[model samples]
Target chain A: MKHIESESNASLKQWKKLHSRKEREKTGTFLLEGPHLIEEAIHSGAKLQHVIVEENYQMKDEWLKERFSLWSVPAKLMKQLSETEKPQGILAVCEMMDQPEDLIKPKGRYLLIDGVQDPGNLGTIIRTADSAGLDGVFLGEGTADLYNGKTVRSTQGSLFHLPVVKADLLQIIGQCKEQDIPVLSTSLQEAVDMRRASEVEGFALIVGNEGAGVQETLQKESTMNVKIPIFGQAESLNVSVATGILLYELQRNRS
Target chain B: MKHIESESNASLKQWKKLHSRKEREKTGTFLLEGPHLIEEAIHSGAKLQHVIVEENYQMKDEWLKERFSLWSVPAKLMKQLSETEKPQGILAVCEMMDQPEDLIKPKGRYLLIDGVQDPGNLGTIIRTADSAGLDGVFLGEGTADLYNGKTVRSTQGSLFHLPVVKADLLQIIGQCKEQDIPVLSTSLQEAVDMRRASEVEGFALIVGNEGAGVQETLQKESTMNVKIPIFGQAESLNVSVATGILLYELQRNRS
Candidate 1:
């Protein structure tokens, strides 16, 4: 196994750049920390560029040893490259997968996010979408970067399970209309009760920013606007919670 | 309106003390920041010791002005007391309400957490429980204090909407039993599919730490063990996400 000890190592410099959205877009790769996430990425058949394990922490599993390109780095160096306080001693660089054409076509249940800035919220929504067996997710402009470290961690490694694509909302909505997929945007005002709304077979449920509901433009363009009935007096549900409820409702209705 | 400008003022020292859980416990009050949260707290009828608004922030809303004891402080003072990047120009000192009796008796549905250390997760869970209309929430030992600034922020002001009490696991379980509420604990190895599990009209769902799930002792004591089945290959759901799914299922079953 190759060993890296210098903070100035070329690969380390590249990993540092992965911390930013611009760098991730430029390289088409993202850094993932911890053994659990790394293992999940490998198991999901994600294209991994390399695996870095802290030199002091050796992998006892023969499976990990046989399957991937392994590199050892000093513990201090690993900490510098990691996002968490206690580095799990394992990290991976994985190539970004292109959104599948079949998955991207508007069909079945999908989540459309507009300007959902919280990385954790974005990741959780993706994981929930996958769990609910949604077809895919589309991200509109100003949404959190899909490959952010916090987003990856929040996904609990579900990032590899489903197709998540970033696209212009106007274009995607137009395509959905062409494909006969209903565009359902969630809003607080002038929205039909989510429970009472018809659960069409194929629909894209759109969620928006925590502070703001869906954009006025998107809301105006939606085929149907629905709101989750709030019996209690909460100003609004968390963006991810709203997504979970809507996804669950869609799954329930379809089943 | 009362105005205080000095950093070393007695009230300022007390406000600074509230930044720690120990201080909150000793004083039987906690500090809440941000306009939205403070507004929610007021709406929920929480007893406010005083509200400190930045001098430049005009209180045009008669409702906020009429209800609470208002104080004005310099912008710098508000910044010093605030946790976020930009102070929202409002902060509150609220008297911690006595743990409500209804919260101790598990009725309908409830959530019990054990050693959940992440403030964000704890806050989100509380908010989820409230939205789902759970009877109450019990914080097991080692969990992050509910009064912490991050925890308060995370609740999105939902902390004021539900009864959250900190207590021992064994005692809480016994109380649930006395109230004839089943205790359901989540685990990977022994859990049946959560969707398939019968919903108890009055029950408590226990979630454990982020790294380690429900403690073995608590698991052994639970009346039912359930798990959310994963269709995809993600390692596990975030604690808050898992809680959301379980609570959603419970609410779904009820209706």
Candidate 2:
């Protein structure tokens, strides 16, 4: 283990740059903080490039002696590296495991997201998909960056548990259709009520933007569009919450 | 209508104090920001005591001429009173509609929250309960304050649309039993599969803390404890998302 006492360390500079999307994409790696997420990454078999811990931190797990390098950082440096108000005294750098679009399997429950702007909402949706046993998550254009701190925190480390593909959702929808996997889209306008829509197996549930909702082109390409009935005075539900209800419903009634 | 230019003004100071829970509780009012929520408040027929706007702001709705008093403040003052990163040039101080505990109707779908800590999660649960047509929200001990800015914002003005009561979970459970309304407590341990729990006409669903799950006494007091089955590696779901799924399932399958 090496001690990184100053931010001027070349390794620390490269780690700090992982905070940016462009740098993360270029290097094919992202930074993670907190013990829960790092532990989760370890369990998910993510390639842990480095694990940075607070000085004299007694935190030890079997994963410590694995392929990942270790660093003991000063409290000040740890605080500087943390995005949250309260630093949890642990951080890790993990390589992104983005799969090629063609590698996406035909038979699996999946979530396809488009233009979800809020990191919290996107992360919650991903976490929900993970809980529902969805096989993968596909991020369409305009969605929040998968490596965003808020998104990562919200996912609670589910990103490491499933396949994440970034590609044109339109093409993905077509490919699913070719493979006989239904592409189910969520819509609030001109759609069949969700409860009435027939539940399906081996499908991809598509959720869209927070405000404008699923794009017209995407909605048209979907095998079917469904809406969760709003029986109360409130106009609508949050996108993440709506996705949760829908994903669980899909699982609950599977024949 | 009044023009208040100075932050030092006694009334402005009083208004600013509403940011604190103690002050909001003492004054029986709370601060609200953004045009959408303010409009929702108006639609819900909430008593809008004061509406503060940015100087020369073009935000003119016919509700402006209603019984509410008005003040035009400077940008700096608006920023001072707003908790969000971007102040929407509007803020309102409206009385809280805390009903006497006895006024809770005997028959209506309800949500009983116990110790949900995150402001955003608590707010989203309340909003989902509203969208699910739940009549009232009974907030038990340890729940985040409804007047919290993040909580209020996450609710998206649902606070104005329903009765949110903060009371003892034990007493509320007793009252629910007295009325013969099923008190369904959510649990992660020693509970029936939620999918198998029969739907009810009028019932109160109890959800507990994000980490602790439902309290033991509350769980024992419930008519039946139920759990959302987890099919994946995720240990648990976010409290708000879990509540959303439960409420919708309750609503969706009602006879």
Candidate 3:
């Protein structure tokens, strides 16, 4: 195994660049760290560009040895590349593929996040959407980049399981309408109880920003406006939690 | 307003100590930042030990000025006291209150987190449990401290609305059984679909850790084991998202 000792090494510098969204877009690659994430990424069949492991990492599992080309690096350099406090001694560089254009076409149950800026919330929503079998997720302007380190980590490697596309809010809404898909937008005001809202066969569920909800124009064009019922003193549910309940309820009704 | 300029000031030192769980417990006080959070705490009538504002912060709101005695601190000191990259110019010292004794007596649905450790996940679960109108939340050993800064922030003030208590798992389970409240625990294996599980008039929904999940002993003692149906390739839902869906389903079924 070839070992890169210096943090100033060319490859190490390049790896750090991938942490930024612009660099991830420029290089068409992203970093996956830790054993669990790397294992899940491998299981998802995401193309592995390179695997970097510390010199002392014991590869007791024969399966991992056979799957990829491994390069050894100093533990310190690995820590510099890792987002976690304790570097897991294993990291993988994987190619980032654009979501297929055909799949991005409005179909089945879709989620559109408009300006949901919290990376953890956005990531959890994506994971929930994937678990509920949503067709795809559309990110409107102001939404956190899907490849952000926190977002990727929070997804728990679910990013590879679903198509997440960044698109214009108005444009996507129009496209859904053209495809005969209704847009069910969640709102705090001017919305019916989610349970009582009629479930459309093929519709898109739109979740909005944390502080301000779905935009006025989007709400005006929405085919249905729905809200989760609040029975307690809480002013509102967390955006991600609301998305989870709405998606689950929609899936339940459809099934 | 009285002004304190030094980092070594008694109140500044006390606020800094709130960054750790041990300090929060020892002092029986926690630090809360941001205008919205401070407002929520004040609205909840939680004892306010002190309110710190930057000297440059204009006193724009009459109601805020009337509510508490405000102390002005330098911007540098305010930054030192805040955890966020951008401090919101305000911080509050809140007195910790003991869990309500009556919370142990179940009246409606409740949530029990067996070993959730992530501060964000714990906070989200608490907020979700509150939104679902659950009776209370039980934090088992190994769970993140409820008063931890991140957990408190994540609750979005729902922490004050819900009766959250920490206890011995076995004892709490026994008490629930004595009250005739069924306990439903989540598991990936050997669990029935949450949808198919019979709805109990009064029950407890138990969520486990993000990775290891509920301990075997807790699962065995549960009245029933339930699983949220997953249709996509993603391995599992985020713990908080799962809690939201499960609690909502239970609430939906009962309604």
Best by TM-score: 2
Off by over 4 Å in 1: A60-72, A104-107, A197-200, A253-255, B1-7, B60-73, B102-107, B189-192, B197-200, B253-255
- In model 3, residue pairs whose N, Cα or C atoms come closer than 3 Å (at least 3 residues apart or on different chains), thus clashing, are none
* Tens-digit lDDT string for candidate 2 (A1-255): 899888799998898888788998899988899989988988877888999999988776676667888999999998878888898989999888746456456777878998999999998888888888888888899999999888999999888877777878988888788888888899887888877664676888899998889998999999899888887777789998899888888777652
Please report, in order, the local distance difference test score of every candidate based on alpha carbons: 0.82, 0.86, 0.84
Taking the candidates one at a time, how many backbone clashes does each contain? 0, 0, 0
For model 3, give the interface RMSD: 0.9
Give me the candidate number with maximum lDDT: 2
DockQ of each: 0.43, 0.84, 0.81
Worst 10 residues of 1 chain B by lDDT: B99-108
lDDT of 1 by residue, A124-238 (tens): 8888888777777899999999899989988887888888998888887887888888899999999987766655778888899989879999999999999876544456678
Native interface contacts retained, candidate 2: 0.81
Interface RMSD of each: 2.2, 0.9, 0.9
Model number 1 iRMSD: 2.2
Please identify which of the two predictions, 2 or 3, would achieve the higher TM-score against the true structure: 2
Model 2 chain A worst lDDT run, 10 consecutive residues: A97-106
- Over B44-79, each residue of candidate 3 has an lDDT whose tens digit, in order, gives 778778888888886557436445668899889999
Fnat scores for every prediction: 0.27, 0.81, 0.85
- Best-to-worst order by TM-score is 2, 3, 1
